[model samples]
Target: MWSFVGKKNQQRWLWHAIDHASGKVLAYVLADHTDAALKSLMQLLTPFGIEQFYTDGWGGYARLLDEDQHEVGKHYTQKIERKHLTLRTRIKRLARKTICFSKSEWMHDIVIGLFINRYEFGLPI
Candidate 1:
């Protein structure tokens, strides 16, 4: 449950990675959707090994899951997708069509990461 928020006028991208099982966010970075960002995420999760992953049909995820046992499909990722909805509701920053309270793409990613870590994973932060 990690993603970047790119505003229509923003220049930077927000990167985040969340643990699905415990809902803990692992890392957050402000970068483009380049190989470096993907690599950084992989490195952050490298110690965990090839755990089961569930993602939508995002091309970036395809490359990230190349070495891991990743599962991609609408049905397979229903839980995460639902989680995203929950996240959007809980975090006003992610709500659609908000103008006054907009987060920088980088901060949005980091905030989501923190939300996942604290709420989803039950982490005491």
Candidate 2:
């Protein structure tokens, strides 16, 4: 999902991993849309023993992910896409055309992280 900090032009990307069966976000990284950001998410998921990755045809996924284990298509990505929609509904900052935007990257990450921790991880708020 995409959002902005300080200004609409400053695009920030939310990259996350979810359990295929449960639809729970396992880990997430908030950064620009780049391979380094994807790498950070991959590192966080290192202990999960993920055998396959279903992703959109993002160039970073193609470059970094193992070809055999990665499948780039809409078919296998519905759950996560739906999850993103739900996030947009719940978080005003995630909405595309809204005045509710973060003033800084720190605030943006904190709000998103807290939301994910409470809802996705089932942690006490």
Candidate 3:
């Protein structure tokens, strides 16, 4: 989970799932970094038939995913971490230490969602 501040410095987590091999974005959810948000991301990833899950040391991953399939470390999660960098570069709201940010949660999500869908997933906007 990655987060950015929205209007009034309200933090919003970007819960995203990506393919390890191809580095393609599978799904994403904009919400708090909580069990419920992780569950929502898991539901989206379920359709992909993912066999392994690489994550950080987040407790939600441990609870939701099978022990055998879950691998915890920044080393294993490099692809997604790189993807976050790409997002930060492309989207001002995602950039750390930037004054350029979304004024509303709705617009913040819409901009990020459209960028991911069009650029990452190759869907027409």
Candidate 4:
């Protein structure tokens, strides 16, 4: 998921991964769409012992993930796409044409983190 901080030109990407069966967010990071960012998300998922990865045709995934473990196609990512829709609908700041948006990177990450922690993890904030 992609949103911006201060302006649309300064885009911030939400690098999130969800469980296929449970449809729950596993981990996420707010950063530029770079290999390092994806690497960080992958590291967060390390403890889960991920055996396979379903993803789009992102160059970073191809570079970072092992070929046998990575499957790149839209068909395999339906659950995550649906989750993205839910996120975009619920988070006003994620909307492309929204008046309410994050003015800084710090607040942007925090708000999204809070929402994910509360709703996805069912944690008391």
Query: Could you estimate the TM-score for every candidate?
Result: 0.61, 0.92, 0.88, 0.93
- Among all windows of 10 consecutive residues in model 2, the one with the lowest summed lDDT is 93-102
Write the residue-wise lDDT of candidate 3 on 1-125 in tens digits: 45555544577888888877888888999987789988998888887898988788878889888999989887767888888888888887776556766777787788888988898889999
Q: Write the per-residue lDDT of candidate 4 for residues 16-100, one digit (tens) a residue.
A: 9988888888998889999999989999999999899998888898999999999988877888888788888899888765677
lDDT of 1 by residue, 25-64 (tens): 5665556657787778678777776477665666877765
For residue 20, what is the lDDT in candidate 4? 86
Candidate numbers, best TM-score first, in rank order: 4, 2, 3, 1
Taking every candidate in turn, the Cα RMSD to the unseen true structure, in Å, is 4.0, 1.4, 2.0, 1.2
Model 3: pairs clashing at backbone N, Cα or C within 3 Å: none
Q: Whole-model Cα lDDT per candidate?
A: 0.62, 0.87, 0.81, 0.88
Q: Which stretches of candidate 2 lie over 4 Å from their true place?
A: 96-99
At residue 64, candidate 4 shows an lDDT of: 93
The residue-level lDDT of candidate 2 at 105 comes to 90
* Local error of candidate 4 at residue 111 (angstroms): 0.7
The regions of model 3 sitting more than 4 angstroms off are: 7-9, 96-99
Residue 37 miss distance in model 4 (angstroms): 0.8
